[model samples]
Target chain A: MTPRKTDFPLDQCRCHLETGPIVLVGSQWQTERNLMVMGWHMMLGFTPAHFGCLITAANHSHRLVRESRECTINIPTLELADAVVGVGNSDGDALDKFDAFGLTPASGKIVSAPLVEECYASFECRLVDDSQIDRHELFIWEIVKAHVDTSIDLPRTLHYRGHGRFMVAGDEIDRSADFRVQNL
Target chain B: MTPRKTDFPLDQCRCHLETGPIVLVGSQWQTERNLMVMGWHMMLGFTPAHFGCLITAANHSHRLVRESRECTINIPTLELADAVVGVGNSDGDALDKFDAFGLTPASGKIVSAPLVEECYASFECRLVDDSQIDRHELFIWEIVKAHVDTSIDLPRTLHYRGHGRFMVAGDEIDRSADFRVQNL
Candidate 1:
């Protein structure tokens, strides 16, 4: 099912990403566009909505994103589990992942990379720093735009446990009362 | 209940960490020790068992970790929710987190940091690189030793979603058949 997303706050992107769910990274360079399943990522800052992820030079999408200096971070729910596995197993160099996985690509407002329409949320990111790229294969990004299907409330996002296993995001427990107002 | 953990392979640390659970970072420097609740961490490499996390210098644990160059990454289950919240909300400078939170600290084999005995898994780490610490407040560590409770097939870990809400890890889905053997 395609989610109808609305513009979301860039700073609040951590609410979805910090949970450490497996994400589909979409990238484009000229005529080439590709999707790659990624799990090594983390939130870095709040003001610029900084995010960081490790993308090895071996992946085809790495070249596309590095050259374009742009990429889309999309969160796919449990419903897209099969496609997530398919995208991870196949080589993006030989096939178009969107077409092969039967997923729709929507144009990003701030980046050239296409967003996955079926994803629960998508963030347009521009490479902010390349210093660590060569040494650690890590890309630091500034999230310029975010789109979320707020209607879903809580998404059953997939979290990779490696070895072909995924743990689905489950029930939520709120302890806002226990937190310091400033900390929250 | 305290889990009886056994030595786990260092290279396979990503199996538990890649899923993005909220972890209790334990650190010690001389007589000073602290525990910080962290959600911003990711696995970077396999052979050296490299891991990275963003910890603002303002955090008391950051100072302790930086000074000692060692820390313990502990994965707490849902049962330790109250301690997790209490540890994150309270200041460690004036308070002894281990005593206040009623958690036991065990000596690590490879690091000076004490591991939380209540946690399902604890990884002893030593700072491997300090280049990004000043610029990004990121600490890159090499996990030298790991301990895990293999008795628990799947631990119901917590994933932070900001605003004091946590998403508990749910059911597991295995797609081993679909994955390429090498990828798996």
Candidate 2:
């Protein structure tokens, strides 16, 4: 295939960077609690449930996460798209994000960070590595506890596609029969 | 909402762990070259283009990456789903994966690893951090070079769901007009 040269536009080129589900990151530090919409988080491992998320130092939740070393990852469906956008648009440092966004924060079983009651699932994580924070702004954590909304039948999650673009999880295709490897 | 009790089956419960787009990782170590399907990778940063991909110690490519400290992340569209599945189904250690999967390995510009010519985009990465390898098997790298197929329009990438289940990226909805934050 003949390839053509493309301009590396920061805003558009970064779209490929977003592949994981967009989530609301809840963080608490001292008397302050905040929720920031994040699309740069991913599951890092299987057995121990390692999770990694990138939060730039400029974000308010980033400081809170660094101070408290704990956070809750809330998975919201398409119904909360507007709220997700609202949470992301505003600065957590400037106001009471929970009150402004009308988000219900419930206490987690393990972590002190509040989980969004509106979300269908929440993962309580504790910081496991911060060595790469200054360089890559990545916070590695282990999911100590998890909760899911059993009432939801099919959860439609949002995937970020740059420049205010989003894609909803679509139809499922089973290809298990095609694979020769049993467990990977 | 009343919640129902559910069992946490490692294999079943972990299905939700997969949220990112699946890519075929191309690696070269010594005289051996291989391709492996991976869904557990994430973009760590933009400038300098830091990336992290979780490769279980068990995967054949894991050793190769550790030795070579370089690899190419090949992004294939939905058209190559069967080949992606085929590459992941067999062991690369025992055979030449390129010929087995009919993948055209073009010489990479920066890394010794060959790029999949059929892929629309490929990133040449050099390992930056292996600190979490023993614990989480996460390899952190910086994308030194990138190539994209500018001619390809509307690239529909596949997202792995669980146990042979996949989700194709659907319609795109733009929400950039609503956001006030300039750069995230």
Best by DockQ: 1
Docking class of 1: high
The estimated TM-scores of all candidates read: 0.99, 0.85
* lDDT measured at residue B156 in model 1 versus the true structure, 0 to 100: 99
Q: What is the DockQ of candidate 2?
A: 0.29
Per-residue accuracy of model 2 over B8-54 as CA lDDT, tens digit each: 22222112222367888999999988899988777676565667888
Which residue runs does candidate 1 get wrong by more than 4 Å? Answer: none
True contacts reproduced, candidate 1: 0.92
Model 1 / residue A111 / CA error / Å: 0.6
- Enumerate the candidates' DockQ scores in order: 0.94, 0.29
lDDT score of residue B51 within candidate 2: 76
DockQ score of the complex predicted as candidate 1:
0.94
Candidate number with greatest lDDT? 1
